[model samples]
Target: MKIVDKIGFDEILLQLAEEASELSQAALKLRRARMGINPTPITCEKANLHLLEEIADVTLCFGILNLSDTEFDYIEHTAKKKYRRWKKRLGIDKE
Candidate 1:
């Protein structure tokens, strides 16, 4: 099915972006703490690992690269078809 025909792509992308940004901020905080004079590498590594897990959870929820090959192929085909139609309507060529 087309992206529009399925759930809203923009909303899904926005949610994924927000989740990624949150994970990035958490990682930065862990990095800064690890660079201190008395750094705790083990603690920092643990926090980073948790952050990675959270990222993976978000990715799975967003269905980003987690779908089966057949499902992904269908999504790609639908997206391309919609994109071509949109471009043509807007007078854009596939150059």
Candidate 2:
């Protein structure tokens, strides 16, 4: 958190991009390694934890990005979409 204030706007955006790429990598580890398409020796827990961390990083980046635009509609849409998807997948929804 201390490092957060030390950086500039553009640097934070760059970190956001880098974090996105890391999220992609973590997803690939789950999809490819689990499917036997990749032999990177990744456990599901490890990959999922990495994914969770990457998502946290992206959200932290958004905290900085949101300083520029308070009304970021995409954030709302994405949060709802992801929440719905996860709830459905985890059997947390009535329907």
Candidate 3:
């Protein structure tokens, strides 16, 4: 096994997780606005901009993995599947 794999490079994943969490939090704030859950609702546009930046940060960390195209394809496929499932559960997706 490669030294990097042996080491597990966990720190990168930690950062990715942090960024992803921030993105999730931002999305939740937007959802609050849309659902009228907040008394003083957040601006959807500002929340979205923050979410976009967090998404970019997460993607940038992904490049540190140096994964092959096939690996990326697998990740993309699985992520899309999960997204679809979540969307369906939220009733945001008709089909």
Best by lDDT: 2
Put down candidate 1 lDDT per residue, 1-95, tens digits, no spaces.
65434666676677678788878877776776678765655577777776787688576655653468898789789999999999988889664
Q: How close is candidate 2 to the true structure, as a TM-score?
A: 0.65
Tens-place lDDT digits, model 2, residues 3-78? 5567877898899999999988888887776777656777877888888999898889878765534367766778
Clashing pairs in 3: none
Best by TM-score: 3
The estimated TM-scores of all candidates read 0.44, 0.65, 0.66
Instruction: After the best TM-score superposition of candidate 3, give how far the Cα of residue 50 lies from its true spot, in angstroms.
Output: 0.9
Q: After superposition, how far is residue 83 of candidate 1 from its true place, in Å?
A: 29
Task: Name the candidate, 1 or 2, with the larger lDDT value.
Answer: 2
Error of 3 at 3 (Å): 16
What's the distance in Å from true for residue 39, model 2?
Answer: 2.9
Q: What is the TM-score of candidate 1?
A: 0.44
Q: Please tell me which model should have the higher lDDT, number 1 or number 3.
A: 3
**lDDT score, residue 56, model 2?**
93
